[model samples]
Target: MAIRLDDITTDITLEIDEDVISIADFQKATDSFLGLVKELSRAVSGNADAASWQVKVYKGSVGVGVSPLSSGLDSLRIRNVMVSGLRALADGIRPGEFTDKAIEHSKSLASLFRKSNVDPNVRIWSQREESVRVGRSVAAGAEKLLAAVYEEDGSVDGILEKVDGHGKLQLVIYDVLNNHAVKCEFANEQLPQALASFQQRVEVVGRVRYRRDGMPVSIRATRIINYPSKPDIPTLTQMRALLSGSAST
Candidate 1:
C-alpha cells in the first residue's frame, strides 16, 4: 500500500512565472524549497536502518496518515517525509537548472509579447490623469529639500566608492534618509561632493562610520553589483558549494 505524503504535491507544480516577480526572487524562493527537500532526503537516506523510514510506503495513498513506526515521527518526521517526495521528484534539480529554465521562459515570453505588439500605453495613463494639486506640491517641496543637498554636495560619488555593491548601496541610501541626513547631525552624512556622482549612476545610501576622534562619521555609499540576468543550476550549485566550503575549486 502506498502513502500519500502530502495533498500539496499532487497537481501542485511549484507555480513560478515571470510577471509576478523578478527571476532572482523566483529562483531564491524555489531554491529554498528545494534545499529543504534535499536536506530531508539526505536525512531519510542516512536513517535507512531505522525501520519506519520507508520511502515507497510514503508514496502510496493507504499509508498516508499512518504515522511512521519510528519513535520520533512527528512534525520533523512528517516534514522529512514530504521533503523526500519533493527530492525524489526533483532528482537533484539544482539552482542552476532552475535559472536556466527561467531564462528560457523569459526569452520565450519576451518574444511572444513583442509579436503581440501589446500597447504599453497604460503606463502613461497615470502621467496624463494624475492630480498634482496636493501630491505634486508635496513632491515639489521634497524636491526642493533634496535640491539643497544635491547642490551643496555637487555629487555623492566619494561616499559611494567605499561600499561594495548594489545591496550595500541601497542600504546606505535608506540609512541616510532614515537617520535624517538633512539635519547633518551625522558626520558621515557630511561627505565630500564626489560621492554625489553615484546618485545618478546608482542609489546612494548614507551610513555612519567612526573617526579617530571617537566621533561618528557619516559616509554615503552604494553597492557595486554585477547581477546576472538569469542564474542556472550549475551556477547555483557552484555558489552553494562555495558557500558550504564543499567546492572542489
Candidate 2:
C-alpha cells in the first residue's frame, strides 16, 4: 500500500500474524518515514531565512492483510520516534538578529506546511546576523551609508599616516578610473608597517564605512599588502585638495 502526504508519497506495507511482526517489514516502514523527513528538510533549507522547521505526524498506519493497524503498535513505533526527532531539530535553532525580509520569507515557507494532514512549520531562530567584530561586504553604487562593510578583491594604493595626537591610522587612496579619492582607517597593529611604507603604494583589504552623501568615509583594514614599486598615485593631501577644489568650483 502507499501513503500520500502532500507531495510526498511512499509505498509501505505491514505484515502481521498470530506471532511476532517480521523484521523486514519494520525496516521498510522506518526507511520510508525517514525519507519523508529528509524531503521536508531539503525543501526548507533552500530558503535563506529559514532558522528552523519541523515535520509532525498526526496519524499513520500500516496495511496488515486486508486491514490497517495504528502506528502505536510496537512494530510501528518508528513513526512516533521520527516525529519526536523532527521536533527536537526544530527546537534546537536559536533565534538571533536577522534582516526583516529574511525573517518574513522564512515565515512564508513555514505557512505552506499547515495545509496538509501533517503540520510542518518553520520557526524564526534568531535575529542576530553577524558579530560586531566581523565585517560584511556591500554592493557598489549604493546611496545609503554602509558601516563595517568590505568589498571583495578591492585593492587601494595610497599614502599611510597616523594622526599625531589621536593615535588613529589613516590611508588615502585615489581611484584613477573614477577620478576620485577615498580614505580608510587601520588597526593599531597595522600602524607600524603602514608608517614604514609611508608615501608608498600599498593594497588594503577591509570593511568600509561610507558617508550619507554616497562617499566612502573610511575603511577598517583587516589585511595590508605593501607594494615596493610606487604606482602613479597621488598623495593623500593632494587628493584631498583636488577634491576640495573640485567641490568649490
Candidate 3:
C-alpha cells in the first residue's frame, strides 16, 4: 500500500525475527497483522466494508503504516484503539476495558511470539507511542481476564420473550437497543416478576456482558421494570391534548 507522510494516517512498527524477512514469514506476518487491524477497524467503526485501509511498509524492522481507505472512518482513531488494546493486553486489560472480541483479535496478532524462528517476545509500536511486547508473560496476564469473562454493572432494555423453566431457569430477552437476544439470569425470588413481565417490553437492570463490537450477550437481572406496550401507551394526539389541557390550567 502507498501512503504519504502528510496523510491522515499513523505509522506503527512491527519488529520481527529479522530486519530482512523471508517472503514466507512476510506473507504470514502481513496477513495476520493487516487482518487484525481490519477486524479492529470494523469493530471501531461498526462497518465491515469500511474497514478498508491503506498500509505502507518501511525498511528495517518490518515497519507498517495505517492509513484511511477513503471509507470515511477515522484511521487515527483506529490506530490509537489498536495501540490501546495491545498495551492494555500487556498490562492485563480490565473486563470492561475491551470486549472479548477485541481481546481475541489481539491474541491472534500476539500469537506471532509462538511462531518458529520468531522471538520469544513480539514488539509493536506506533510513531507516537512506546513499544509494547507480547509473549508468555503477556499471555499469562491476558488469560486471567479471558478465563473469567468480564462482568460489569449495567442494564439492558428489551422484550422478555423466551423463558426456560427446565434447566438453570434462564430467560432470553430481545434487546431493544442493539436488536439482539440478551440472555438473562434472575434470582428465584424474581420469578414472579419475570413471569409477570413476560412477552412485554421491559428494562432489565443489572450486570450486562457486551461484545467488543457493542452487542450485548447477557445480563443478570437485579430488577425488571416493565414498560407500557404500544396499545397501552398514549398516542400523539392524546399526549398533545393532555399537554394542552395542562397548559390551559
Candidate 4:
C-alpha cells in the first residue's frame, strides 16, 4: 500500500542582496533556492519533488510555497524539515553537535547558493517567518568540507520504516544515531525479505554508500538480518546458561 497527502502548503523565503535585479540573477536565486530545498526534502523524506509551486515575490525578497505534484507526497514534512535544518545551519550548529537530524550539517543542503552568485547572507526565511541567512556561506564551505559518496562493504542496522517506489524498489531504514532515514535498494530476490521485515529492526549486509560526512545513504543489500523482537530475545543470563549447558553436553 502507499500513502498520499493533500493540499499541504508551506513557504521558503529567499532574500537576495541586489540593487538591480536582472532576469538571469532572478533565475539563479530561484534555482539555488529550489536546489537547497530539494536536498533538504531528500534528506528528510527520501523524496525531493515538490508538487506545485506558487511564487510570491515581495519588494525585498521572494517567498515560495508549493503544492503536491502527485498523490502520496508529504510536502509539509519537507517544509518542516527545511525549517529545522535551516535553523541548525543558520545557528552555526555542526553535525553531531547538539542534535543531528536527517539533514546533516554538510548534507549538500546549502550547496547551491555558491552557484547563485547572489549575496544570501542578508536573509533567508522559512514557513514560520524565521530567517536563515547562511545560505550562501553554507554553500561555499560545503564544497570544501563535505566529502563525496563512496561504496564499501559494511552493515547498518535500523528500523525498516518503509518500502517505496514502483519500478525501483527501495527500503527506508531509520538509523538511531539520528532520526535520519537511509534508503537502500535491494535486488528482486531480496524484495520478499525486505517486505517481510518492514517495521522490524534489521541489519542490512552488503555494499553500503555514505554521504560525505559518513552517513549511510545507500545499501545494496546482499542480506537482511532481522533482529529478534524484544519479546523474542532471551535474557543475558538465560543465554549464558544455555551456552554453559551446551558446553557441558
The number of the candidate with the highest TM-score is: 4
Q: How many clashes show up in model 1? A: 35
Clashing residue pair totals per candidate (backbone < 3 A): 35, 10, 0, 4
lDDT of 3 by residue, 105-214 (tens): 56655655355554444565655555566555555545655552557888888788988888777888885654466789988998888888888898888988865445
Distance from true position, residue 181, model 1, in Å? Answer: 40
Q: Pairs clashing in candidate 3? A: none
Model 2: how far residue 141 lies from native, Å: 17
Q: At residue 168, what lDDT does model 2 achieve?
A: 69
lDDT tens digits, residues 12-122, model 1? 122221233445543543443334333333344343422343222222222112223445434354343442332322232222212222222222222222223432111
Error of 4 at 2 (Å): 41
Candidate 2 stretches with Cα past 4 Å from truth are: 1-155, 159-167, 176-179, 210-215, 230-249
- In the range 1-249, model 4's lDDT, one tens digit per residue, is 111112112455555544555576556566656665555555544553442345554533343444445454565565556555555554544433223332333333344344556544334455544555546555444433333368899999989999986878889899867666777888888888888998989999989887667877777888899999898987898789888885344
Considering every candidate listed, which one attains the maximal lDDT?
3
Instruction: Report lDDT per candidate.
Output: 0.29, 0.37, 0.65, 0.59
TM-score of each: 0.18, 0.27, 0.47, 0.50
Model 1 lDDT vs. the true structure? 0.29
Off by over 4 Å in 1: 1-19, 47-249
Off by over 4 Å in 3: 1-10, 17-28, 95-97, 113-121, 148-249
